[model samples]
Target chain A: MGRWEPNATDRLVVAALELFETNGYENTTVIGIAERAGLTKSTFFRHFQDKREVLFGRSSLADVLAEGIAKAPADAEPLEAVACALELLAQDVFTPERRDFIARRQAVVATHPELREREALKGLGLIAAMTGALERRGLPALTARVTAELGALALELAYTRWGSASRDFTEVAREALDEVRSAAPAR
Target chain B: MGRWEPNATDRLVVAALELFETNGYENTTVIGIAERAGLTKSTFFRHFQDKREVLFGRSSLADVLAEGIAKAPADAEPLEAVACALELLAQDVFTPERRDFIARRQAVVATHPELREREALKGLGLIAAMTGALERRGLPALTARVTAELGALALELAYTRWGSASRDFTEVAREALDEVRSAAPAR
Candidate 1:
């Protein structure tokens, strides 16, 4: 029903992840990934700029998540707004096929110091953007920043738990959020 | 009238920071830093295991801050307890010399990806410890985690601003907390 041009990008990503897991991230080249995927070097470069981008290519998710948060209903509380934003992000940005891929990507990144630093920077950038959105909603700067950070922490915990082989992402995220709420001081 | 032997650890840290700023973090070795501080390789190793530790030797402050939060008066609200804990930490953990040293260390870490990840992991560990403290106070798990994350966020923002050339740490922290309160939705 839909016109798809062989989904070259997905093919590239899958090949890259496989090569990274088997041969180590540093040892896998763009040419090797392309060859494994049955594509040419030009096709690989057409989809990704370099080897690092093969694993870290979804940085665009940050912008999409930030926009979702910024556009959340104004009537919602800061925490609720952030949660809704994340839920929407989970549905839109994290598909089941991509989920396993992401888990492997995270594992690879976690093992490499340089990749971990890049991941940290990416997380910081998302939190900063969310903070800005909250500030625009008449929240004070520090409050906005705290709310954003809290949201990020919750997301991180949920992602880590969900990425485990035994769990599903949605259920894990819901449980994680509930855990966060239950831990709060009574009003 | 003072009967204090010079702190060999502090001297090493200072020398390391100076060398890192002058010669770049990767270029400055442990032996060079120790020599500049009039200490030997053994003395440097006694104080710090590696060059990286010189920039990351502040985990003790996290322990003190967590302990202070755990021991806050029973009647204080979670956020209030956290603020009080931070105040105590500022007095006991962050001396004037340490403040300047930390600021320099932050600049160096910010520029290097590996150092940044180490900082993130350190921050995550501190937040987890604080969350456990809040849970022990009967706060729900989620709430405790959120509150701890918020506290860390506030501290990070305050510290970054204070660590700048123009501001004091305590003053910036107080201001940041006030901003957080003001940003909260009307109850």
Candidate 2:
């Protein structure tokens, strides 16, 4: 709790991110992550199936995104609902305290192909989550999916800008979404 | 050629898809694919690094799409360039003779997580290719990426329709692209 993590999972993730950044993702092992976290090998195994799972945590962003979108005002449109979810992410997940570590983790992921594949799959999962959330709000399937892809693209853009921009994640994400809207090619 | 292919690579892809569908993807192996193709294990290795690599062949969609866009009329818009590329795919890759096999291959991929991940990464590759192609046509980076995403979404929709519809791939893809444009949220 002292370092902002309430459980062994965060500790393990933090330890793994450091080791991955320093020693390389390929060189780091589950046993090493466990030892670094001051936890046992069994604890690491209990928490994750493998080292790659460490980078993607047990936080379950799909659930988070879903919950955030669900909480948006009843009359909000699809993109507006998506905006609500991104704002919630800025508040809860992408906190100021975690920004440095998040940037570091991204750098580690960028250099590894296996990690990139996992990241891509995770992105698809997020988009699916947003799509379902939008559909539940009564948008048509195609509109829901298109809106979700745009939201996901904005999230990707804001993730890159969050650390660099003077603005926080919410504002950066808003700007990104606006950029997507303006840049979107008219048929 | 006995079938449509004059080379070993196409034979291996066809053989691998058959084996993956008959046996589960997890249960299939490189040796099995080789045996099914009537080629030696060494030849299979020479053609592909592994079983998963067989699904993603040396016939890269990125190169094909890029080449098609490059061949489009200089006055063609980004989406039009994408249409030209999809039309090229209809002519060369998604021929009537290969439709059944293509559908079979897609089904095999849908049920497997590893294959889905590969497909998602492959999709990212296609989007990147489209982005680069659009950028070379003088569009801005943001515009290029957004246009490419729309194109990719349309391509995805058309893929689900190509086998089921009475029409050929070109018409289906064009309609899908139009659907994407209309379905796109007005922001």
Which predicted model would earn the best TM-score? Answer: 2
> What are the DockQ scores of the candidates, in order?
0.28, 0.61
Query: Alpha carbon lDDT of residue B133, candidate 2?
Result: 89
Model 2's chain A TM-score stands at: 0.93
Cα-based lDDT at residue B142, candidate 1? 66
Model 1, global lDDT: 0.74
Interface RMSD of structure candidate 1 (Å): 4.4
Candidate 1 lDDT for residue B126: 72
Cα misplacement distance, residue A104 of candidate 1 (Å): 6.2
lDDT for each residue of candidate 2 in A55-126, tens digit (9 for 90 to 100): 896667788788889999999877889999998998889888878888888899999998988888899899
- lDDT (Cα, tens digit) per residue for candidate 1, span A111-138: 7776775677677777878888788888
lDDT of 1 by residue, B1-187 (tens): 3233278887888898898889988899999998999888888777677888877774576777678787899987887778876787677765566677678888888877767767887787778778888888887766677777777767777778767746556667767766655544332
Reference-based lDDT, residue B146, model 2: 84
TM-score of chain B of each: 0.86, 0.91
